[model samples]
Target: MLLFRLMSALLGYVVILVTGKATERFVNMAASRGIYLWDITRVREGAVLLKVRLGAVKALRHIARRTKCRFHFERRVGFPFLYKRLLRRKALALGVLFFLGALYFLSSFVWFIEVKGTERLTVPEVLGAAAEAGLNRGMPKWRVEPGRVEAALEEKLPLVAWTGVYIKGAKVTIEVAERVVPDAEDNRPSHIIATKAGLVKDVLVLNGHPAVKEGDTVSPGQVLISGEIPPLEEPPKPGEEQKQGEEANKPKKPSRFVHARGIVRARVWYDGYGEAKIAETGRRLTGRSETRVSIKFKGKEIILSGDQNIPYELYETETFVKTIPQWRNLEVPVELVTIKYFEMAEYREELGIEGARSLAGERALAEAAGLVPEEAGIVNRSLEEVQTGHPENIVRVKVTVETIEEIGAESLFKP
Candidate 1:
């Protein structure tokens, strides 16, 4: 019986504390709007007390000019010990929650590391590289210098040719590239060969015998300079020993050096295809004003901005579907803001044979224009034919154009 009475007293104290806090907050909020709380206390039945406030009533009366009772009246008394205990409990709960939240934010980077493009590199090697790059546990991600880290990683592992490091929230993503190995096996004896089937395009014989002269038309794989040597050197016969000795005394012919340059044109076949749909597209505005809030604890930021907004249209032939759930850094939903623009409708049309042919011709011409240099005049354009197919509504057209210009063919050998 005594325990139950004690529990009831504690419960009453908590209620009084919460009600006092709520009333205080409400009065403060109202005071900002020029309203005040007029509190009054009066003695009631012996130990009981009656408290009344007319501040809200007066404010309401001013607004309406005729109010009877806009304010609430309550009577209470004799629970000082219970009120103090409840207030303490509420404060303790609030303090504990605040502390826990702070601790969670401070130590939230205990997750796993994700290494992308690690085919050539082992996971441990990539992790080690990241550590060397200053990306480690408990370290604020933004502090990991991307430029310095990439340079350090490349210096440490020569195999990682190219690298990109991004700290997405807590995940540290590392994209890597392996070093390229050149082919060593020579089908023919290693020689200085013409790179292209051009008129010996400026041959520079570094360490070989010259075979072709300038302006000579050489085929593909043709040796511009030879590394081979004659089996034996011509020597004077038994009677010409003195003559051979005199020749040796003379300076040996300067190493057979040659520099050949020529111009040659070949029928370089090239095919280009480009596809452009009549569908709608939108470009984001750059000068538009945007407000973003970033919550950071220790260099790690929580972005409160959403991705770009694309418009959608109903009652129109074209429709753009866009959906955004939310962006979260650590299970906490970030802010989201979206703006959409509805576009006008577009009518579909069926193309006849001539229309299809004309469209195909236009596409082919556009492709050809891209292939030939802008300065190079497109003299000839021969359209083969326009072939149409069913089910897969497509028009195929082949266009051949002729232009006189220098074109490169070295990228085909690059790895």
Candidate 2:
């Protein structure tokens, strides 16, 4: 049925009203003569209405006359009549074609450029590098080679480790990742000290005297390895006894101080607290949005399309304004503004004690995990609820995390 309707519309069809005493005979004669008619309806005792293809309209006149009926066309539809109407108004047709051509031409050039994921390097620096590689704004998108831009960005900016270039519609985006350079190592006479309070899990002294052994509890700034190296004492000869005055007469051995280097593994504990409300109320977007576009000229605004009034009562709005560029001393006072409205709804949720506690524990654990070093080995984790004397509507949880990591830091000193 759909295909028949489409073919009928394409070939052009017409609705006609037949009047006379023999209208029924007219339809029957038309059908017998291989003339097709659809949507036939009896308007009155002596009149009928029906539709026929444009090609069969002349044939219907002969049938109508033979059946003593006179028919007149009520409506002319399909492409044939539409084409005739367009021919009558040539200017309107030309304007529509010109608009489409202009739209296609403007879409071929890049209008906006954005840089993402950039740190330590300014946007102008990245753009300058991209421009040198033929990826500038207003350039034809087909001419901007993404591979060439990526290589040039990494080469021109030494700090850029990697880059990604993307072209989407009329906008171009350049993303960059920076390289991280480690500080130089310092080697001087120093001692390795604890940066935090922790229990020593393992101690490996490489180039210094052990100030504290394994299983020892240490505080912040406490020396784990000493830079001072004591001189070795000579043992007494076999069966030889030395007097106290003879030892006093012996020359004193000088203590040597050197740079300390060692690995001191310790169990560091981090505590974090978090709270969640049992009953919470908040507003969030409902994921429904509408856009309104307008043009501003000479301090006046004219709406181009979209609804004049906002449909949502509680909604958030985001707007973007674009203006024509100035050339030489001439500037066009025209800009296009697009405003988007997003619908929002308020919601309330009831989380029981167990649910609230679970949420609070997750938050508390995340906070405690942030304190742990990336290279540290997590040994244990525990979560406990804070008990209060009075009743409250909030659930508070504390997280304690234990991780084994190297806590030895060098502390320099003079002899």
lDDT of each: 0.51, 0.92
lDDT digits (tens) for residues 248-343 of candidate 1: 796654333222222323333334443322332433333333333334434454545533333333322222223345466544433332333334
Compose the digit string of candidate 2's lDDT tens values, residues 295-353: 99999999998899998989999999999999999999999999999999999989989
User: Which candidate wins on lDDT?
Assistant: 2
Q: Can you list the residue pairs that collide in candidate 2?
A: none
By TM-score, the best candidate is: 2
After aligning candidate 2 to the native by TM-score, how far in Å is the CA of 143 from where it should be?
55
Superposed Cα deviation of residue 65, candidate 2 (Å): 74
Worst lDDT 10-window in candidate 2: 180-189
Task: Quote the positional error of residue 207 for candidate 1 in Å.
Answer: 9.8
How far does residue 186 in candidate 2 sit from its true spot (Å)?
A: 8.0
Give the per-residue Cα lDDT of candidate 1 at 297: 39
Cα distance off (Å), candidate 2, residue 41: 61
